[model samples]
Target: MKNFKIVFTFVLFLLFSFSNAQKIGVVDTEYILNKLPQYKEAEARLNAQIDTWQSELQNLQAEYEKKRSAFENERVLLVGDQLKLREKEVMDLDKNIKTTTSLRFGANGEITKLRSNLVEPFQDEIYSAIRAVVDKNGLGIVLDKNKDNVISHLPRYDYTDKVLDILLKGSDKKEKTNSKGKK
Candidate 1:
């Protein structure tokens, strides 16, 4: 019985030690993406596109307003087929404006599609970098600081900068390769 108890205690100690060996890391992906110039450029381009779309939408709305006002002013003068034609024209224009707005600004719209296209690559790159960092550091679990509800953590456990380093290094390598290819 004494020998069996000693073996059981030893096994428990080993299990605890092994369990404690795994390291947990936290990464702030948003911070890393903000530091990346490529991501910033992509975001700027998306913003510009959104601005252009908003301007176009505004123009369409102004046109609709103008037509509606004109129709209201000349509504009395228009009679029979003329009145029906003018009303139909205004309704058609309003419908066109709504269609354009929905096509460009709706939930599954052009802007959302373009944003996904522009941002997905960067997100993939960041994910890859995070994976590489985790592997390199032998981290057992990694959490996104932005996504996870992390109340407190040690600075040493924060691997955001390390992930960013990997990304920046990867970019540098690509730049070097591109420059060499150009030469």
Candidate 2:
């Protein structure tokens, strides 16, 4: 079903390209992002935050394990209320660990939220650059090279470098303006 849609889209693209005599361009966004220093920095920051969260989770897991082991060892000596209290403590710790994990790494968790926040600006910048490149070259269709559907395209139609160049130029201008303002 997906393949059929891709083929249909490709056919339509070809029809549009030939019928209108308009150019279709492709871009490798991954390549562009890798070349972007700001994206690299954002990725690094995200990774660092992930590492810290992982460490915290590990510590909680270790504590849970320790308490669980202690509870098992003292099971024979503990009375009804004492055993219940200890079991409750262990269970509470387990619950706390699960909650923490979910809050930090779940589908709608802190990591997902942070990643979206961090990457959104870069996505906007890339989109703007791609739009500018498409407009400047009068391209009717712009396909992402990263998509599996884009099987092959001519080198001439590959506008990845042009988009990256625009992004780099924009950043350079921003840096110059920033530096001038600081001085």
lDDT (Cα atoms) of all candidates against the true structure: 0.92, 0.94
Task: Write one digit per residue (lDDT tens) for candidate 1, span 1-183.
Answer: 999999999999999998789899999988998999988998999999899989988998898899999999999998999999989989998999899889998999998899899889988998999889888999999988998678889999999999899999999999999999999
- Can you give the TM-score per candidate against the true fold? 0.89, 0.88
Give me the runs in candidate 1 sitting further than 4 Å from their true place. 1-11, 14-21
The Cα error of candidate 2 at residue 173, in Å, is 0.6
Q: Which stretches of candidate 2 lie over 4 Å from their true place?
A: 1-19
In model 2, what lDDT does residue 76 have? 97
Candidate 2 matches the true fold with a TM-score of 0.88
